[model samples]
Target: MARRRPVRAPEPLRATSMWRVDQVFLTRRGVRVEVTCSMVNDQGGLRNLSVTAPTDDPVQAVRHAARFIAGRGNVSSARQARVRWAREQTTTLQDELIRDRQLEDEFLDEFEETLSAVRDQQR
Candidate 1:
């Protein structure tokens, strides 16, 4: 009689290219990545940020963190740097939101002024 080899288990689930993506959450391996990006206007109104990434890539995990920050909140950065900055900025953003009075309004005003200056330079 011959001995049989052990069977391999199925691979864990991950985000696939076929996923129906939302602007808010991207989940994989039971890890939920919630995105909250925004742009602060000169009028003190916070606007959402846009996040983009390839779903099927293993690198998407890294992008997920950045997406979570840039998706619906006022986080800024691009590519890998975005992911790195997102981690620290996200936490600071939360703390600012919690304790600081009128933090959102202040951010909006500052952002708007900065944006206006950039646009002016671009013209």
Candidate 2:
């Protein structure tokens, strides 16, 4: 009889002051990337910020999500620098998509709708 090794339990999610990539998966439209920012408040309560980005590439999606969250404030200078880097990368990707004519009208409509919804929610 062969002995089986015990399975280790999955690690718990750690809260961080900066946004961290939580999950990435494919969707019918494109790849979806989810990020989370968690921190403990002065009142000992937990605060969390989460956002998802739908894009062709997971890396670009993550950068987009990070840039979005970083705009919300309370981020460190180092994190802000990282966000700037992400913004540049995202811009390059967008240019490439435009140059390649890879962006579909349907995708643009959906993206505009999502962007409007986010803006509405912010207000």
lDDT of all predictions, in order shown? 0.36, 0.41
Provide backbone clash counts, one per model. Answer: 10, 0
**Residue-by-residue lDDT tens digits, candidate 1, 36-122:** 333343334444544443353324433454434433223332311111223333456554333222323333344345545555665
| Residue pairs of candidate 2 with colliding backbone atoms | none
TM for every model, in the order presented, reads: 0.24, 0.32
Error of 2 at 95 (Å): 34
- Best candidate per TM-score, number? 2
Measured over all alpha carbons after superposition, the RMSD of each candidate to the real structure, in angstroms, is 18.2, 14.5
Q: Write the per-residue lDDT of candidate 2 for residues 1-123, one digit (tens) a residue.
A: 999999999856556443332222222233554544443433355555556666556455545554554455443221111111222234465643332112222223333454555566779
